[model samples]
Target: MVGHTLELRGSPFLQEIIREVPGGERIVHCLQCGTCGGSCPNGADMEYTPRTILAMITANQRDKVLKANTMWFCVSCYSCVSRCPQKIPITDIMYGLKRISIREKAYQETDAPALAKTFTDLLDKYGRSFELGLASRYYLFNRPLAMLKMGPMGLSMFTRGRMSLTPTRIRNVDQLQAIIRKARELGGVS
Candidate 1:
């Protein structure tokens, strides 16, 4: 039975989104190196360590791989990215997998997806990210406690210009919209 091992072995979209990083091949080249496992900050809690993720990806068991807890636990710390002997941008791969999973509407993250949408909308509105608007929407729509937690150290960060209460918009907003339009078509942004 094929079960869910992989989807017929010729997943073109997987190849499309997966960049040809110089040394990124041979996620199979792993030496059973505990390096990634040992280096991961959240490895202990993961059902699959970074090493296991690599194996699963190479096996073409990506759906199973994406559903695992390790991907969810990743903080995108780039710790594994720097240390890999294969020099694979494993973090980028994780992000790519998350993107596909998200685009398919397969699962959900309590706040990250909506917040990501808001951030993407902000990017489409301007050329870059705006933390203030993102945080406001995140707090208002999802977690009110985040506002209370930040309330203590919030003002100091604001005055230092580390955070802005107002969103800074770029002069050419239309150009940004065009970019988002293209990205949505190319399967990068949803």
Candidate 2:
């Protein structure tokens, strides 16, 4: 136990995670038990399971951990949190990893970041997500050729009334914006 503690103390990556993420201090208690990974619904799809990511963090594999597609694959269902014996906030840590990845531009290969930015931007602007607008903006900005190919599917959805061209603002958009702004401030998200 003493040796493990010394190793944890020496890991700058682990310290960074503990400092930046809420509930991250519990990471040191992880037993390498695979419960968190087993509980994840999308576990198979992730490049690295939650357990492996935690191991990577402890091992100070900063580049591998930050650049992995594991965090982006997390659906934030909190299943891992519910099942973890150490009470680690696995989902929350995934979110923290995502923020760090974005800030560092470590996710250059995936379009998930661009899609997320477009979705959040629309949410901030309209207080609700417009599916058509979201898809249009995401594809137009990130994958223009893909947008051309999606024309038929988009038209089909529009014809089926599954999508609307115009965004619908919430009745109290100002209130929503105020809450969002305060949350950003508190989270230091800018």
Put down candidate 1 lDDT per residue, 86-120, tens digits, no spaces: 77677776666666666766544446567778888
Please write out the lDDT profile of model 2 over residues 63-182, one tens digit for every residue: 999999898889888989988989999898898899899989987578988988999999988999889888888988889999889999988988999888789999898898999988
The lDDT for every candidate, in the order shown, is 0.69, 0.88
Weakest lDDT window of 10 consecutive positions for candidate 2: 181-190
Say which candidate scores most in lDDT.
2
- What is the lDDT for 137 in model 2? 81
Indicate which candidate wins on TM-score. Answer: 2
Clashing pairs in 2: none
What lDDT would candidate 1 get against the real structure?
0.69
